[model samples]
Target: MSDYLIVGGGVIGMMMARELSTAGADVTLVDRRGCAEESSWAGGGIVSPLYPWRYKDPITALATWSQSSYVLLAQELLEETGYDPELRQKGMFMVSVEDADDARRWAAKHHRPLTTVDADFLYQKEPHLKENLGEALWMPEVASIRNPRLGRSLRQSLVGRDNVTVLEHQPLESLIIEGEQVKGIKTHKGEIRADKTIIAAGSWSGELVKPLGLNVPVEPVRGQMMIFKAPQGLVNRVVLMDGRYVIPRNDGRVLIGSTMEHTGFVKETTEDARASLYETAINIVPALADHPIEHHWAGLRPGSPEGVPFIGAVPGYENLYMNAGHFRNGLVLAPASTRLLADQLLGRTPIIDPAAYALSGRVTSG
Candidate 1:
């Protein structure tokens, strides 16, 4: 019997498993398809949300904490696994002025440095950007990581750990409940008993927890992204216009993403979305129009009602916890969310107030 059985092998689940195993708990992680191949792998990996000031406190708290810890975490992972997640602190450039005032206010309140740059400075920073694009906001402290690399490194780091068991391609069928407690989980293979169970199943978390009568409200929000092969310095930093973004990797690949669709569980990439993203990319950086498209794919983000993830005990159930509904920010928020969930499970005080993320807390818009 395992001390903890985590359902889902996305970044959130893997991070939770790592934390639990590091703290001397025997943890078993099961994934339906494969670990980290879902939203965690498909995300753009910007360390902060597209518009940080737009989200409420509950969402910002976790994001900020995780953002603060990513540098050290990346260093540790690099040392342990020799896989650089390519943690880049090149900063984020915002071109949209729709919510500039609101963003400025929030930044001031939160002590985040938000600078307004003129056209000359913007062109100096990112020469490839479209000319005549007026003033923009520069968030200097923002950073990004290669999310797929990070996920792979986390999995690699767990290979020889005696306390961790990672099971891929094991789809969970149902939960084994006894009165008010969750006994274990029923996978396609067979029954596996556990002292506690955590559902970090990403977009599929709602279906897995529905049998237990816990309405987690986690639904699949499909986001499609396109990759373009370019020179290493084709795009100098992360660029944003409205909700879409362009991320340049250490390698010569530039990632342009994404569209949030309400389609239910369908991960297919649409040509329309591809074209739309291509147009958006070229609109920001005209040079991208000359680049060849390398790849196009989609992933389903675990979206909650208010875009905030649940990271606490399941109401009315003992030994059951959840860490899902992160929507588009899972990659950025995973570190802090996992720490908070692990602390709660181990009877330790959480780094942030757990009330806002509790299962019973009132849902608020991000």
Candidate 2:
């Protein structure tokens, strides 16, 4: 019997496996498809929330904590796997000034630096941007990572671990529950027993735990993205306008995304979504209009009621835990979120208070 059985092979599940295995726990991670092929692979990789000032303190607290630990984690992964997640500190430019005052107030309250830049300064910073965009807010501390690479490196780093076993192509059929405790899971292949089970299955977590009478309130929110093959210096930093964003990779690939549609579990990409994303990308940096779209894809984010992830034990189940519902910020929040869950499961003092993300907590939408 394994010490823990984790259902989900995204970044969150992989991170939890790495942590628990390092701590000498027997861990088995099972995924429907392959690891990191879901939302974790398809995200824009921004290390900060979409609009930091617009979220509640609970959400911001988790994001801020996770952002601080990303650099160190990236370095460790690079050293171990020779794959750099490309943790870049290029900062982010928020183009819309409608919420500038609210953003400034939130920044002050959170001790985060937020500067308003005029058009000239913005042009100097991002020369590729179209002219006459007025002023923008500069979040100098914001950073990004290549999330797919991060997920790959994390799985690679755990490949040689003696205590970890990764099972792919195994869809979880149901849970092996005895009264209030979950003994194990029934996958497509066979039964695997474990002392504890964790539902890190992202958007599918709600269905996985419904038999236990736990309402995780996690659902799939489809987001589509378009990749543009541009010059390396096409966009100097991450450019954001409204809800759409354009992220530049170290290579000549610029990622333009996305749409937040509550369309259940559908992960299909639409021509309308592509056109909208392309128009938005061009509006931010007009030069991108000339670049050819190399790829277009969509992923389902595990969105919750208020965008805050659940990262603790269920109310009545002692052996079952959860770490899903991160919405679009899964990659950014994975390190901290997994660490907190691992600490609680291992009976150690968590680095952060886990009460804010409790399963029974009230949803607060800011």
Candidate 3:
């Protein structure tokens, strides 16, 4: 029996396991697929929330905490696992934005560095962009990591840990419940017992805990993305307009994404999404139209109500916990979410207030 058993081996599960195992607890992490092959791999890896000023305080708190930790974490992972997650500090530019005053106020309140630039400034920064876009919001502190590389680093790091046991392709059949407490999980191979169990199964998290009469409210929100092989310096930074974005990798590959379709577990890529994304990418930078689309894919974001994740002990169970329902902010929020969960499990001081993320009596409405 392990001290902790994590059901999903995505980034959340791996990070949780890392946190616990580092604190001298034995951990066993299992996944239906291999680690980091799901939404963790499919994300664009933007470190900040899209339009940071628009979200409520709960999200801002988590993002703020995680952003401060990412730089150190990335360096540690690279040194330990010999895999670089390509964490880059390329700033993001939101062009032709509305609610400029709200953005300013939010930045000032949070003490994050933000600036407003006119069209000339925007053109000077991003020469390939469409001209005459007016004032845009620039966040120079924002960073982005390559999602696939980050996944690889996490998997490698977990495998190298002596106290961590990874079980791949082991699907969780059911939760072992005994008198209102979850003892462990029953996988296809056999029953694995643990002192504590966590359901970090991403979009499939709600289904895993439904038999326990707990409504986690995590659904699969499908997001489709495509990549173009462009020149390395074609697009200088992360560019966003409306809900879509264009992220430029250092190796001359530009990523364009995504559409938030509320499709249930349908991970298939659609022509409509591809066409829409392509149109948006070309409109942002006309030079991108000349490059052929190298790849197009989709991932299921674990859509939580109000974009807030449940990250504490389950309400009705003694030994069960949850860390799911992050929606589109999973990659950006993983570090803080895992730390909060670990802090609670280890009986240490939590980095932030835990009341906002409780599973019981959660305010799902805005």
What lDDT does each candidate get? 0.89, 0.89, 0.91
> Which residue pairs of candidate 1 clash?
none
Task: Please identify model 3 stretches exceeding 4 Å from their true place.
Answer: 363-366
Q: Weakest 10 consecutive residues, lDDT, candidate 1?
A: 357-366
Q: Which ten residues in a row have the lowest lDDT in candidate 2?
A: 357-366
Least well predicted 10-residue stretch by lDDT in candidate 3: 357-366
Instruction: Estimate, for each residue in 118-177, the C-alpha lDDT of model 3 and write its tens digit.
Output: 888888889999766888999998999998999999999999989999999999999998
Deviation (Å) of 200 in candidate 3: 0.6
Instruction: Give the clashing residue pairs of candidate 3, or none.
Output: none
lDDT of 1: 0.89
lDDT of 2 by residue, 253-293 (tens): 89999998988988999989988998988888888888899
Leading candidate by TM-score:
3
Identify the runs in model 1 with alpha carbons over 4 angstroms from their true place.
361-366
TM-score quality measure for candidate 1: 0.97
- In candidate 1, clashing pairs total 0
User: Each candidate's TM vs. the true structure?
Assistant: 0.97, 0.97, 0.98
